[model samples]
Target chain A: MKFIHTGDWHLGKLVHGIYMTEDQRYLLNQFIEVVAEEQPDAVVIAGDLYDRSVPPTDAVELLDEILFKINVELNIPVVAIAGNHDSAERLSFGSSWYRHNHFYLTGKLIYDFRPVQIKGVNFHLVPYAEPGHVRHLLDDSSVHSHQDAMKAVIGKMEQNLNPNEPNILVGHAFVLGGETCESERTLSVGGSGCVSSDLFAPFSYTALGHLHSPDAIRHDKIKYSGSLMKYSFSEAKQRKTISIIEMNENGSFEIRERTLTPRQDMRELEGHLEELLDPKFYEKQKTDDYLKVTLLDDGSLIDPIGKLRKIYPHVLHLERKIESVDQKQLRNFSSIKEEKKSELDLFEQFYREMTTAEFTDEKRELMAGIVNKVLKEEAQK
Target chain B: MKFIHTGDWHLGKLVHGIYMTEDQRYLLNQFIEVVAEEQPDAVVIAGDLYDRSVPPTDAVELLDEILFKINVELNIPVVAIAGNHDSAERLSFGSSWYRHNHFYLTGKLIYDFRPVQIKGVNFHLVPYAEPGHVRHLLDDSSVHSHQDAMKAVIGKMEQNLNPNEPNILVGHAFVLGGETCESERTLSVGGSGCVSSDLFAPFSYTALGHLHSPDAIRHDKIKYSGSLMKYSFSEAKQRKTISIIEMNENGSFEIRERTLTPRQDMRELEGHLEELLDPKFYEKQKTDDYLKVTLLDDGSLIDPIGKLRKIYPHVLHLERKIESVDQKQLRNFSSIKEEKKSELDLFEQFYREMTTAEFTDEKRELMAGIVNKVLKEEAQK
Candidate 1:
């Protein structure tokens, strides 16, 4: 069974006061052409169908047009789930009728892991949920973190799984070793949102979303197709692509990447303002590409952004390299400071603020033991 | 064939800083019961599915649930259209696939009126559009007012009309003699929006919306089902109902009103603050009904709304009777003053205001001729 794995379209994303709807539409039009050529058994959009709960009207229209073209016109089964960015209820509208034409869109998560069976392959879709919600759904006190929630969810799915048959899991989470970048919202306050790749061992392939870079995590069976486009300057170097996975009869899959040409590439440039603005230098670059330019000149430059925009119409952001160098040092110093604090000391402060009770030696020792156990478990994963 | 004609749902309506979603849900629950009992062949919702272009998420959910129940669960066909208050593009989502399930939702108006045929009856749905939009669609320079737009639309429908078939026209417009309430938005600045009832003579029945009162216009063939609820204090006295029509094989129909009781009835109350507050008066009434209290007391009352809300949780508005009486006379005098002006005199003043060019004798004679002709046309209708 062949599956085109893609997600994190973020259809109505806005950065630096500019909407990405047109850019999204341009890529989606190209995506439809890709779907037409590939003719996969089904398309798996892991999650994050929209950038916000209440997307703009044009964004809504664009989604409607694209979904209709793929599911109706192309006659392909769309297996999708709503991510943290979507309002589950809004996305669930007309979903019951949508299934008649093989368009499977799951917004709200359910306790039972009902797999969508298409051509003998069982595809289980798990939409992003808060740890608290998962805890409530499973009625388990042990499900206190994203790892625990995934463990509980996988446990449920495994009960009905046939290991010999092909099984694919589509999910949105911060899996272990997935590199983080700007524009991706932090899943939790503390470091409790990461799940291990070992939990997805039973599945032939696990198509994941949430992280914006395709190189976020690397496992033979688990992979990230990445976001449809670069949403922030931090993601400038990462090339976005959709993974086409062909699962063999023996439950082994071979994956290939199909690069999508964005309407305007998002990248960064660093140089002195005058040197960067020279006609010979500017003419050689893709001036219209969405850019974040960093000026290295020490002296002040008047209206540098305005001057750059005359050439690079889509220049999203401008910054001073000198200021960033200072900020980078500050960030490094802060991280070192954060790491220096012992687990018990951090817990004591957190507990003091969260509760009225005193942090006794007995409580401290118990917490220390638990923290050590968690560290050992994380290392093994 | 039995048809339940209803319109102007105006879901997500906000009045006096209160959301009408819950109340709308309550009424819709009752409406579904009525539908279940009647088992109508098709439920025709003329227009105005939402109060604003972008409704709250809850409103969308409510519409989804109700439509699902009526069209999917109960197996009754639904015919609905978008009104001036709706964002046509938002409503058009999933419309192509919806037809297979007998859910006919028309948002955008096409040049040719395509009738949805069900049970041997042709139902022509005309969604609300501005005169300029209709003008652009028809490419007719003469389409200047709502009347002209409707005339052109009806003319297009007539070209494809088989009058012998039981034809019913569903539209949203301000027909002539429609007694509009405060909640109903003025369709046009002048009297040009009023379409004569005689123009709808071809269709066996013309179901209209936009006017909040069912008695907004009076004709045997043309009727308004009225808005779902009392959306304003001015609509306090009007009774809201849905029309149940039985169209015979001969293209004639008999209509009956099925009154719907709102969760909180909207009504006016005239009394002194003390009397209204007294247990004797309060105990005998439904205090929870949405009230527009007209206090007869001459003196000031501190925190009257807050005080009244103790017993009447939905006291929507409070006003002094004396102040309103004075305002009513002012309104009457203004209308009389407006009526006293001659057409030519008003035109010259209007012409002087609208244009820099002088109003010459030739222009005055031409304006006078047009005004007289319009007056004669209006009189004949």
Candidate 2:
């Protein structure tokens, strides 16, 4: 049996406060094109299908179209689980009915060890779980951390496993040696979230998520397919890939890595404004790539995005740097500064530093009065 | 052909600021019981299955359970449509695959009016459409009102109608004489939103939504099933009912209204608190009823909800009335009447009215400064 293993689409991701929905669609379309060409027996999406729990309508519609194409049009079984970023209840809305059509989607942790059997192969889907939920489900007080909870979950899986039959484990968690990107949220504190790969050795092949790099973690049978796209600038150098696993009659598995081609590469450029505009500096640059351009101009550059996108049409982000002016001139009036200034003065300084605007004495006096009133009320309390 | 015609379940409605999910469940269960007992040839839910476009998770789960039971377990067909309140794309998510088992859910406004032929009955489903969408779909700029739009929709329906076959039209809209509760949003101004029943004269019967009263609108072939439960306090007197229709070979339909047995009755009690407490006042009250009690207690009653629920058990809303206070009288204040007061006086009055505690002199001075500063800035703007 041969099938494709992919996960962590993170459909509505925003990088550095910039909306990445358009980029996400471009990359997801590439995945679809690959699937159409490969035509694998089945598709297993491990977890983190969405970046946020409440995805926008457009992202939901895009995912809906892909899922419809895969399961309905292609007639291939697709199994998916919810990760830490998803609201399980929302994702699992019609899962019970969806399973009738060989579309296995599990968001609730109660069915952690219930393997979905299709054509004699058993697929055990384990969604991400909290330690508290694990402890409550296991009815054991000893499981206070994720590691302990995972051990209990593995023990439960052992009961359901049929050693003679082929079995595959799909999960979302941090395993040892897993190279996590900046976008992957911390599951727990103090490194307790990471679990050992040996715990999942029982399965023929374990597909995992929670790490963006496909080669982040390595074991004999465990692997991370990585995220669908480069989510952060840190992952720009990473070669994202999906794993295609083929299981023989003897229940042994052979895994092959297939490189993913993003629609447009993600690139960062930093230099002085004049050199960036010289055109000679960008002879080797991929102009169509999504760009993060930072200008080192001493003063703010006019229409930075317009200027950068002239050479690179997909300039997704732009920032201007203005050198700080010397403040030694203020040292001459330091005598009065020793006195306790009103809170309004502090507000004015903060306003000036954060926003490009002018402040007046009347506004300062008003802000100070409001702050003083609140403080006075707090004192009475 | 025998069928159940129900609409506007509105599963997650809030009545008078009190959540009525439990009451909603109660009536919905009664609806299910009716379906089981009647054992109709099919179930047709017109539209507005959810109260809000973004329903709560529990409401989604409840609807999922009912649909599974009726369509899968009982092996019955269900034809539904999207109401004005629904997000069409979300409702149409799994509709493509669900059509195999005869669950025809039409969220998009199809222009051709292709009827779903099931068991020799031709069911034409026209989901609620905005005037703008109708005009765009029909490619007629003159269709600027709902009446004109709906007329065009029915014209499309007439083109596809088989007069010899049993035909039924299911829609979500306000017809003439349809009494609407506060929960139902008005589609357009005046009578423009309401389409006359004569539009469906060619069909055997019509099932309608967008009204909470079963008896609000009536015709020989057109009927509203009404909401499953009283969605608001204003609908306290509504007798929630579903229309059970039986079609004959000659394309004629006989309709009957079946009252729903709710798990707990919803009622409103209006009287003086002292009188309400008297056993003679509420001799007919269902003790376990979900209630909204309006007390004419002259603002003398303390802990009204705490006091009323002791007897009413489920006092969902408790509003106190001390005769009808005029808005002018309510806004009349001693501070406003004072002469030549500064911004400090305004701040002090505002603080005093909103808080349980008083403001100090320092705080008052600070507030005055802030208000003055804000006013000065506004003047410049």
Candidate 3:
């Protein structure tokens, strides 16, 4: 049996205040192309199909279109589960009817733990659930964390397991030792979300989501397909990929990675403003890529973001690299109480602090004229 | 071919600040029993399955559970459409896969009008669409109102109609001359939402939703199943029911109404407070019903709502019916302008207006003492 293992599509994700649905649609189109070419027996989406419980309409539509293409248009069985970012009830809608088409989507955890078997391969789908839910579900007080919740759920499946079949476990969890990025939401306040990798010892392959790195964990059977694209600046260095697994008649499987090329890469750049904006510096780079640029120049620059935007249109973050701030702060101290000063005086003080330049007589005169005109308007009101 | 026609469930409806999902669940369970007894060939849900575009999680779960019981468990086909309140794309999700299980849910209006056939009956589903959407979909500039939009959509379907088969039109529309209730949202600012009943001339039966009254329109073949329950006080007198249609081989049908008994009935009670509280008058009434009480006692009352709540726990609204208002008005007039008067003076004037009594010296002394205490506390602050 062969299948494409992927998760954390995070459809309708917002990165730096921009909706990523179009980017997701583009990448998913590519995914469809891959599915069409490979003709995999099944498509296993581990979890986190949406970025949040209530995703925007476009995200929902995009997911619908992609899932239809894979399950209906391409005629492949899809096995999926709801992650923490999803509303289990919302995702579970139409799931029973969908199963007839070989589209199995498990949202809430069930104690029976029936495996969906196809072509002699048993796929155990364990959707993400809170420890409290597991505790109540199993009538066991010992389930107090994500690890314990997963253990209790998976342990129930093991009891009903057929040892001869090539077993595969699909889950959404933060396996201990997996590398994480900023965009991945913390499942628990502390490290209680972490589950041991030893839990998947019985399965030939374990497809996981939650952490954003493709190489999040190192094991022959356990793997993270990673997110579809870089969701945060912290994941700028990560290479996003999908995992393809081919299982033999025995329980052993060979897993390979296929890298996905995002429309524009997420990257970080640090340099002097002038040097960074120069045509020679950015000509070879993907100028439209989402960027976090840090200015190395010590002095204040006028409208630095406005200037850099001409070269990098998608500049998401801009900040100055302040060096030796304590030395300059000590030299520029003044003892004028802000509450005792007029609006013009406060404006002058703010100008001096930002520019480290004197409030000249000409500028002060202009400021005073503006303040008077504003006060005159207020008096009339 | 036989089918149960129902719509305007408004599943997460809020009536008088109370979520009506529990009541809806209670009634829908009865609807399931009706379907089981009838063993209908299909269940046609016209539109407005939810109260809003985005419903609460419990509403979604309830809809899912009911749909599952009908389409999967009972193996009955379901034909549904998106209404004005529903987000089309969201409801349309999983529809493609659902089609295999004989569950057809149409959201947006498509130019291609295909009939979903079951048991020799061809059901033409027309989901609600805006004038702008219909105009764009048909590329017809003449489509400017709800009537015109419905005309254009149904006109397209006419070309593909199989006249030999028994055709049923399921829609969410405000047919012209339909009596609307307060809970039914106005489809348009004026009368543009009204579609002529003549549009359904080609179909054997036209099952509609939107209007809360089951007898909203007077036509032999065209009808509304009404909302699942009375959503507002204006609909308190309206009997909520589902329409069951049994169609014959000769393109004829018999429609019967099945009354749904809600767990709690909404009613209005008008009488003197003392009379209403008397067991002789109240013993025969359903005390648990949601009640709107209009007190006929024109005198000053202390916590009338609090008093009535002891007998009627679900009393949602309360008001006093003032008799001979001119008598009270003549006694309450004073020379002092309301804006210039102190809070205590304003309170005294309000009391006089309500009671038609003079502010006696003893009452005045008591009022002065309370005012002085309040002022002292304010001064300390």
Q: Please, what are the lDDT tens digits per residue for candidate 1 over residues B1-381?
A: 999999999999999899999999999999999999999999999899999887898999899999999999999999999988988877877887788799999888876587899897899988998899999999999999988999999999998899889999999988887886799877788888788888898899999888988988878898999999999988888879999999998888899999888999989888988899999999999999999988876544688888888988888888765433345544654475557778887777545433435789999999999999999999999
lDDT of 2 by residue, B1-381 (tens): 888888888866666576667777777777788889999988998888877777887877788878888888888899999888776767776776678778888876866688998779989998988888989998988887777888888888888788888888889888876776777876777878887777778888888877878787867778888888877677888888888888888877777879987777777888887787778866767867888887775434467678677788888887755455444533753437655766776666555544424588888778878888999999999
Off by over 4 Å in 1: A110-112, A135-144, A155-164, A272-279, A298-303, A322-381, B110-112, B138-142, B298-307, B322-381
Q: Which one is best on TM-score?
A: 3
lDDT of 2 by residue, A253-327 (tens): 888878767777887788887888787878877788877787766643577778777888877777654334235
Residues B1-381 of candidate 3: C-alpha lDDT, one tens digit per residue:
899999999999988899999999999999999999899999999999988888998999999999999888889999999999888878999998888989999977777797899999989989988999999989999999998988888888888899888999999999987997788877788889889999899998999988988989889889998999888888888888998899998889888889889999998899988998999988988998998999878668889899899999999999776664576454445545644877677777766666767888889889989998999999999
The C-alpha RMSD of each candidate to the native structure, in angstroms, is: 16.7, 8.7, 5.9
Per-residue lDDT of A330 in model 1: 46
Relative to the real complex, the DockQ score for model 2 comes to 0.32
What is the model-wide C-alpha lDDT for candidate 1?
0.87
**2 or 3, greater by DockQ:** 3
Candidate 1 on A266-324: residue-level lDDT in tens?
99998988888899899899999999998886545688999988988988888775543
What does the TM-score come to for chain B in model 3?
Answer: 0.87
DockQ of each: 0.41, 0.32, 0.69
- What's the TM-score of every candidate structure? 0.81, 0.82, 0.88
In what order do the candidates fall by lDDT, top score first? 3, 1, 2
Given candidate 1, what's the lDDT at residue B17? Answer: 90
Cα displacement (Å) at residue B243, model 3: 1.1
